[model samples]
Target: MANPQLHLLELNAKTGEVFLRLRKFPNIILTPPRWEDEPLLIPYLNDPRVCDWLSGPPYPYTLQDSKDFLARIKPPADEVIQHLKDADPAAAPIIVGECPVWSIREVRGSEEVFLGGISIIRCENGELMGPNGVDWENKKKREEENNALAVGDPSIIWTIGDWLAPSHHGRGIMTDVIRTLLNDWAVPRMGVRHVWATAFTGNEGSVKVFLKNGFKLVTTHENHVVVKGKMRGLHLLEWQYEG
Candidate 1:
């Protein structure tokens, strides 16, 4: 469970943006995505080196794709938060699982530049099952298997995913960000346990990021996905909270 004191956050009422300070690196912050971030985000999505490993969005990612994606995952309105507060004043204003994405940025002088993005979603049986095209029976079986491990309800298992801009590569920025998110925010604020992640076999950099952040390899799916007409393997990783 989240610390009650950290439940409600201060947000910019006009822009609906909330800023989170990085524990060790106070200059960096995790903020809500804004319309102006399209340019910063789209380039990375369009880059073959980056998008090839990712699952969704057609390559040569367009302005429209960026617009559509942001719209789909936008956080709830202020009125929704107010309603939740009215119902339960003590509850966290924003449910971590409900809001799936946050933009990672660094404060430079008076401006903050978008560096990358981090996301988490609730899954069942360690699988990314969403509202569209779901298999309930399979999900049930997976949940049973997951529950048997004494890891709590599999249906509520939260998975973490991230992507960083190419320009910021090799700086260890993402590794540090992932660690802070898991330790300071996700575990403490979201009460996340058994967080999951997957990386393509060839993507050694991402594999290192997960491993360094304390995720253990659980399984490998050979040729699980096809990208650019070639088969690719995937390694599944998990981080379980003991405390």
Candidate 2:
């Protein structure tokens, strides 16, 4: 609470970057991944306790993997800024033709700390989930064949994914992150009407994070996906934006 509005004021004073401030935690912000994040990204992600709940990250979470991830998630900062200007502040973070990803960051007076990542991915039609979980294998094939990112297509489904370092868990930081993203950015600016997410049924913390942000449990897929040679039950949650 001591941080006050200065955190945002300081962040916004800088040029050529976008920072999504968490409504409750004034020091916490979300910004596009930077080259400097590579070193920290590896360690935070390598924690099995953190990785087991996630779907995209592979085990070990090497430095090269972090580099490629940072390289690949290219958020159009300029476009987002322009949209903000056009809307006079209430603007969109459209990953229309690019990836909509942001690094979870904590800021002190002069230092910014990388915490984790939050991204809204456009799930392909009829491919949100398969029998064995996320159906990422087919999703990759579609990406490889099409060589194109979703371009605000009406039919495309949007889903969000996020991870927080183990050090920050149980404090409800992720709940605030999702709430800030939806209420401050995704809903008001991007016109995100619906977003879906999945979590292992047993992972009550993850499930609670989404539910706290107004996501409703829609279904549970028993033995939905195979992870580490074992089947895991995954539950689906959906958030419908209400203006």
Candidate 3:
């Protein structure tokens, strides 16, 4: 059953500010990345403890890398205003990669501090193949398989990914973030039926977060990623909206 209280907040069309309201922490908001966030993002991306688990933004992340990432993930300022004015959450435009990414920030007095990032990518007619063995470089074969399965234009599936600054660890912040995104945004606003996520085997914290948000364990992929010269396993989880 859907939670009646789970609703998306209205975006301020004039200011172009998008936010997800949290019951416990009203000051925390999930919004689009801003130009001022580059500095806050750089240190987190460069942190070995943080970057090792992520698939992109090469080691020793730089300012240029941060700039490029912001550019790629954030939509144009004018487009943001338009989407907010439309008053339809699902109508918000995503930048390149067809993924909607947002910055998790905590409002402190007059300032908002960047805490982390979250994103969801929509994949249509794609199987929940374990993440380990697939050769993503072979785009042709993957496309063929997807096209074959998409004959009738099947329902869209979504994959979620997130990262938080080391400073925010152990605060239960991400757990709430995941829950809010799934219950409020992904399922209700975006209307995604199935949502998937992957976490490295040793990262018990992330696995717990997904489980708390109702994601069931699907499979484990051995040696799914190489972290700091060593191979690591990955656990894939899924959440299906019954409504």
Candidate 1 — which residues are off by over 4 angstroms?
A: 1-16, 77-96, 124-155
List TM-scores for all candidates, in order: 0.76, 0.77, 0.77
RMSD of each: 5.7, 5.7, 5.7
Residue-wise lDDT of candidate 2 within 167-195, one digit each (tens)? Answer: 88898799999888777666544556667
- List the global CA lDDT of all models: 0.66, 0.69, 0.67
**lDDT tens per residue, model 1, 7-57:** 433454456455566666777777766777776778888887778878766
User: Which residues of candidate 3, in runs, are more than 4 Å off?
Assistant: 1-7, 11-16, 76-81, 87-101, 123-154, 227-230
Task: Sort the candidates on lDDT, descending order.
Answer: 2, 3, 1
Best by lDDT: 2
Cα miss at 224, model 1 (Å)? 1.2
Candidate 3 total steric clashes: 0
Score candidate 2 by TM-score against the native: 0.77
* Cα RMSD for predicted model 3: 5.7
Error of 2 at 200 (Å): 1.6
Clashes of each: 0, 2, 0
